[model samples]
Target: MTLPTTAAAPPSAPPRTFSAVLVANRGEIACRVIRTLKEMGIRSVAVYSDADKDAKHVALADTAVAIGGTAPAESYLKIDAIIDACRRSGAEAVHPGYGFLSENVEFAKALDAAGITFIGPGIGAIEVMGDKIRSKNHVMAYDVPCVPGIAKPGLTDQDLIEAASDVGFPLLIKPSAGGGGKGMHVVEQAEDLASTLLTARRVAASAFGDDTLFLERLIRAPRHIEVQVLADNHGNVIHLGERECSLQRRHQKVIEEAPSALFESLADGAAHRERIGEAACNAARSVNYSGAGTVEFLVSDEHPDEFFFMEMNTRLQVEHPVTELVTGIDLVEWQVRIAAGEVLTVAQSDVVLQGHAVEARVYAEVPERNFMPSMGRIVALAEHGAADATVSGQQPDHANVRIDSAMRDTLQITGDYDPMLAKVIAWGEGRTAALDTLDAALGRYTLLGVDTNVEYLRLLINDSDVRAGHLDTGLIERKLPSMEFRHAGPRELIAAALTLWLERPGSAFAGDAWKVPDAWRVGARGAWTATFGLPGAGTATVSVTEKDGSVTAAVDGGGPVNVRVADRSGTGLVLEFDGGLVTYAVGSAPGAVREISVGNDGWSCRLEVLDRAERLRRMLSGIQREEGAADPEVRSPMPGTVVSVSVSDGDSVEEGQVLLAVEAMKMEHQLVASVAGTVHLTSKPGDLVKADQILATIHVHVATEETANTGQNTDKEVHP
Candidate 1:
């Protein structure tokens, strides 16, 4: 394929400044790009799916276009829809924000063919780096040190086994066409090679539509490091130091830090940075790359001198903000300028590392449930004030803590997009200061209704291993079993109990009674018992008994405790009892009350009664029944397409046997028989199944007495 040469400026043609650019992506990245365009005096166009019609990014954009259905493939990934949106909206350029089509070679080519400048690397660069095998070979050609691996095509099962043996145990099987850790597996022993290969192939085939796999030697206790590179059409390229993305879950980065602690630990830190930077520059120059790109490497923990190339992301990365914080450069602006036939203004010598910066990706996910994406309405968002604050011995004003978000209280978080809600970044003169500021900022941050990984991120920064920078891709999994949520102390608990009790249905101050001083109990004590729902946290029911002079409360199934209520002149009621203290400042209002509670541990909280019926409905709905009575028929656990049905009607199968396989989210889940029985297949291969669909029936074989009893129980259960 012949690459398009950089066009020279025509004497008669004027430099065209785009009036508006259509963001062909969703979520934070879309918002990030729009912010840059707005700053540059350019109008921004947003495209959204049915699920994101009212999203924050859509509202923030100058104009919005409804693309199509909710799924990415139908909306954001639809090239024609995006192009039409640009044409209809008078958008001059199309910015495919990372993910959907950001690095897609065909997408870039289509944009070029349509005479729309794609705000990213050229199609040639994207094509060269989009394929893992091709990118690996290209990087190696530049003498860029890479992980010893095979990128050759067409490897049979036996060939892969032999290659795995040659690479030795503890190797990685990765798809040559995949990235983001998808279609990747780690084999710890020779016996696990075959299974790992099958799994990797299956996932790769499903995700990238390519089943070819490659092998690489696994680096033990490796830290993920990547150097940011920017290139111009004028053959100018430079490196922007490195960011440490060691904190990960299932190979997905959760937190990233610039000027890694691992780098500082080296005896020759300055020399090592220069070496890595040069290699990264060479890799970019080899591809004649343009715009913002990231060259990732896996650095050895024991030997910091050794590093290997992982892959090259041909666009701005999710954690690019960390680099921006330290370098003080707007990568998006540079990408636009460079694409406009501009020269690189900043040289390698001009690039300076200012301070330590850390960024935590706040994802809408349940950490307790293996980080599954959580979808729901965002009820509230609270963030701490960014001011001069000393944390972890570093002053934020001096270190600089920044919060970049594209979320508002009214937006709905749906599963159709990436689960990330925001990126919280903190900078400090040193590692301790940076981490400390981030931790403090995280503690003050709050999101309600939908579960977030904020609490988990807080725990991770405070963890002993993370604090010491002993991190790897497997850190989350290894430490998850021992991880626990930070709990509200006794003082906070007591205050919460008192607040809920005071706001109970039968309380003395019922519906505007607080506004009438005459309604106050001259010397009467009021008491009530109520349940307080904690959402993700389990509920706690408490009984509050008030006397003429004092109030006493007892938590459900617990001992009684005295409560001290202090009246703050105009603030509200401050309840102090047990080890917790909370302040309820509802004023003299007679309607719903909003209460604030502060634990002695520094985790402050607020509770508000929005609607009684709605709250009750939600609280009751949160409780899920166990297994729905366990029907004898095997059902699909999630929405997916059946790949193959292994059994037919009346075929005898053993317990724990695979009945069929369903693929969802690029992972294959096997629907297996719980008991040995004759299978009655109802769904065939390639059939689309919804969650809880009865794929097959299992008729158990038993003795005469057992059969009679089983039949009776089955009839009752099925009928009930």
Candidate 2:
């Protein structure tokens, strides 16, 4: 099989055809690839795990194939199954859309052996750039400056310590085989190096099937900037400029923007930008790289000209939409065209960036509690600012907003894979306009059922420092303390009360609720109190009394306020509470559970109605709950497999000691004891546990002098 060896090769004799392509991955990227395939008039073959039978990507494709189970190892990562699905579906090409098998060289080799075109770089490039250590070594010949550290793979802990000592403190221990912030750690002290390395190696081995580690000097406040390079088989390699990915949490990027603001701060910004692009093209040329790839760098925030090569992503990045918005190039389409022996149409000099663009990754996670991955069904979702917003009453800027997501209403966000639910991208003429469009877009975006970081992203977009272009890798972590979690306010409380009132079958407003103006009567102006439960917090008692065409209400023993019905329905209600109107989208299942979403702030809560008797019962049972709370049992925070157990059934443990580690959503969470006690283990390593399942019980009353080494009080305290 001959390949193109020149920069502008002549067209092939027959013009190779790709009638159908199999997306060997899932989630947003798969959908993204499928969309491009549709535009190119090619059939799309989607493969899914058992968990994704009803996924949006599967439904969007022309045909679908069931691979295997929910775990990626049994499904998307299985080369044999993917190839079989391709053979059955008549797919001529396989597009590994990032993650899973995207960077897996073995999968590429298998596809090559099966006579399938892999829509990425060839075997040599994959082998060279897929490994971080190897990529660093290869790029050195092209004058690509790399971070100063050891690149030796599979180094011993002692060797790593010595290397760290040479690299200085605050260095990073990263896996060589993969990216995506997995299996990466920062070592701040020499003493903590060994344990951190061990854990890093463990995560790398589990996540990527390789434990090979690499050491690099940490750039304390460097901005993460990566240049997107597109290469064709005809030796055409051009860069689409850089994407600023500094705002990160746990080393994973939360927000990314094209034409980095850091460059905007530079005096010779255009010259520096062209220099970086040339360097990226040089990096791509180093390995005869083909298809769409990213060359990441850690640019000094203080010195814009100083940058170091990080690593080459051999696949499309999660933040590619932002680049497409700015450059007007469909990278996915280019990947396919390049694989089919097409020459690059746009030259490096002709490529131009039109406007600023920003992309915020919407995730199923909690921002306040350390960004723990939240999983469950998304009951509702509403998005806006799509096609750009007309801001300041001016003619709409050519800027626009786009949402790339694999999520839909009632889609369960399983813990089997990544927690990113969607990507919301916005574009405008300038940074301020782009950010303002992003803010409006996020304000209109609402996701319910599982917890999301929508509100947190909104806060981040509105942040003054963020607006001022002050960004770093640690920006999210530094500002996290100031980002507060909001709850159901007065409007939500009033809506909840109104919903309950309308649901009562015995009330006069039950059947003909719309006709009766004040039919939610409690014996004609009689006052009644109903306790409504708040999600994640205690209940609020709403006392209401119907009067002439209106109602007087007091929430949680607060001062009485006038309330009037703006509108009423069986499934929803709009009420004016304290002269402010709010609407609630109400949903109820077969059970007594009700979901209420407030329109004012998009605050949605799942409430359980408590009658007077049930309220009294719960209050009385609080004593029993308090008793259980006094002697706390450590539980799994999410549904996952128990990776390791640090304590035995009769082991004496100190407070803050790690009881066990749980692996969920491609990350590890260590569960620690809150009190000093003797632990009784209920589950062992490799045991599967559901969310909130008790994993171990720590008894504070254990009669062991050794357990009281700290001399702290053993008296029961309320569990935090």
Provide the RMSD of all predictions against the true structure, rounded to 1 decimal: 7.2, 4.8
lDDT of each: 0.73, 0.80
lDDT of 1 at 154: 87
Lowest summed-lDDT stretch of 10 residues in model 1? 385-394
Residue-wise C-alpha lDDT for candidate 2, range 197-251, written one tens digit per residue:
8888888888888899989988888899999999987778889889999988889
TM-score of 1: 0.79
lDDT measured at residue 644 in model 1 versus the true structure, 0 to 100: 69
Best by lDDT: 2
Q: Which stretches of candidate 1 lie over 4 Å from their true place?
A: 1-16, 154-159, 385-399, 487-540, 546-551, 562-575, 583-720
